[model samples]
Target: MRAFVFPGQGSQAVGMGVAIADASAAAREVFQEVDEALGQNLSRLMADGPADELTLTQNAQPAIMANAIATLRMLEKDGGVRLAAKADYVAGHSLGEYTALCAAGTFDLPTTARLLRLRGQAMQAAVPVGEGAMAALLGVDRDRAETIAGAAVDSILAERGPPLVCTVANDNDPGQVVISGHRAAIERAVALAKEMGAKRALLLPVSAPFHCPLMIDAATAMEAALLDTDLSAPLVPLFCNVDAVAIADPGAIRVALVAQVTGIVRWRESVLAMQAAGVTQVVEFGGKVLAPMVKRTAPDLAAISIVSPAEVEAFAKTL
Candidate 1:
């Protein structure tokens, strides 16, 4: 079986989909649609970037999704590959979950783009700048990271009035863990993680501390937006980031979507579950970032990263 996966925030770069966009009119149409949806020339920013502006949360969210979807469109129109016929399941990491759902026919492209824009904005607004921060604890498993975060929480509580919230934001893989919370708490956790034998603890450049209880306000914002939006059952099952399971029910998906605002993104477990479910091949759309993660987590699975027109044509040959 085959699983199609979408990449998240860190995968985006300047001039992301320019090759595909220039090569195929169908790909250009995808960019055009996203431009119309957000009422901005996101395509221009994506193609020619000052790099700083494109990296902003609001712009990066939809820009990454547009690139992924545009690449998929190229595969379909130019390479004669159809997702409905070729892919058995689809999954994505973090914000990429929305991109996966869009590819699976759950939410339309415009709705997905707008929702992500709102999501990015809401998340950024949840905490004041510098008040919250996220750090990556490298070379440590989730359990160890959790323990470190707990210790940080204890220290913060002893020093301050209440227990300062700190938690594992993402269990990216066996050796890659991300922790999120207040700036002081996260720094405390980083120091503790290094003492606990973590190889490295580095701060992330993200605008918000995502996937932690500190994002409750962002969750509330997402709840309002999601309730008002139209969501249909995806054509393919989505390996949700929260549960690490394939969810197809629209209502259940909605519930998970809301919970994901502050829930741990179980990306490692999700990929393992896909492997257990007989997914021997994994195709990553638009960017190559997820392909390396899959390689580390599931070395036996055949992983392909489709970005340029040539890669799309090559992928079509297998189908």
Candidate 2:
């Protein structure tokens, strides 16, 4: 069995999807449809980024999805690869979940673009700038990371009123975990993680604390938006981030989508689950970010990252 995965944020770059779009009209249409849906030239922003603008939450979310979908389109049109027939399961990291759903036919490209635009806005507006932060703890196992996060939150609660949020946001791999919440709490967690035997702990450059209680407002906003949007059942089961299980029900998928806003992204467990389920190959679309994580989590599984036209052709030949 094989799983097709999509990448999340921090994977976008200038000139990401240009080659695929330039090579295939189907790929160009994907970019053009997304641009029309959002009422702006997002393809230009993606291909010729000013860096800061492309990095904005609103832009990055849909841009990453577009690149991934464009790559998928190229694979289908030129490489003779079809997702519904080839992939056994689909999953993604964070915002990449939307892209995975897109690939599985849960949502059309226009709907996915619009939904991601709203999701990015809601996530960004959940907390004030500079008030929330995220930090990565390296060389610390999940158990130690959890203890450090708990201690950081408890210490803040003991000293501060109205309690503050601080907890593990992502379990990226065995040795790397990310914590998110109030800036002070995250800073404390960073310090505590190092004292708890972490090799290093450093704050990330993200705009807001994600996958924590602070994103409740974002979750609520998503609930409303998702209710209004029409989502069909995905063609294949998705290994959800919140549960680390494969689910194909539309209603369950919606619930997971909303909960994932403030829920820890159990990426490591998700990969392990896919591996245990007999996924022999993991094909990562759009970017190379998730392939390394798949390698770190399950080295036995063949991981492929399809980016350029050559890589796409190479991957299709193997299929």
Candidate 3:
């Protein structure tokens, strides 16, 4: 069986999806749809980047989703590869979850685009700039990373007052984990990780503390928006980031989407679960980020990432 995965934030860059859109009319239509839905020239921002403007959370969230969906369109229209026939399961990272759901027919492209826009705005507003941060710990397993994070939070709580929170945000792979929360606690975790023999621990260039208790306000915002949005059962089960399990129910999917704002992305465990479920190959759509993580998590499983039109055609040939 094959599982199709979509990349989350941090994988986006200037000029993303341009190649596919140039090569296929279907891809262009996808971009046009997203541009109309958001009521702005997002496609221009993605193709011709001022870098900083494209990197804003509000733009990047839906821009990444548009790129992924456009790539999927390329595969379908040009390559004759359909998800219902070729994929057994679908999963995505962070904001990419919206892309996966859109790909699986859970929501229409316009709805997904609007939802991500709101999600990005809500998450950005959840925490003010400079107050929260995220850090990645390299060469550390999940257990050690958790230990370091806990110690950092405890130390901060002893010295600082309440509302200072730090927690593991992502169990990305066997060798990498990301922590997020208050800026001071995140900085403290970085220093503590270095002292505890971690190879490297550095802060990410993100604007908000994602997947931490600090995002409770964002979660609440999403809850209200999702309640009004329409969601259907996906064509394939989704290995949710928050639970690391396959979910099919629309109501359950809604809850997971809301809770994922402050929940750890159990990517490592989700890959392991897919492997246990007999997924022989993992195909990553949109960006190349998750392919490497799948390789690290399950080396035996064939993993591939498709982004450009040439890559899409090449993958189609295999199908």
lDDT of 1 by residue, 113-196 (tens): 999999989988998988899999999999999999999989888887477878999988888989998888999998788888
Badly placed stretches (over 4 Å) of model 2 are 159-162
Model 3 bad stretches (over 4 Å): none
lDDT of each: 0.91, 0.93, 0.93
lDDT of 3 at 180: 96
Model 1, C-alpha of 225: deviation from truth (Å):
1.1
Q: Write down the TM-score of every candidate.
A: 0.97, 0.97, 0.98
Least well predicted 10-residue stretch by lDDT in candidate 1: 156-165
Q: Worst ten-residue run, lDDT, model 2?
A: 156-165
Query: Candidate 2 — what's its lDDT?
Result: 0.93
Q: What TM-score number comes out for model 2?
A: 0.97
Using TM-score, give the best candidate's number. Answer: 3
| Positional deviation of residue 278's Cα in model 3 after best superposition, in angstroms | 0.9
For residues 1-319, could you state the per-residue lDDT of candidate 2 as single tens digits?
9999999888988887899998889899999999999999999999998888998999999999999999999999888878889999999999999999999999999999999999999999999999999999999878989899889989888897567788899999888899999999899998888778899999998998999999999999999999998889999999999999999999999999999999999999999999999999999999998888889989999998999888888888888
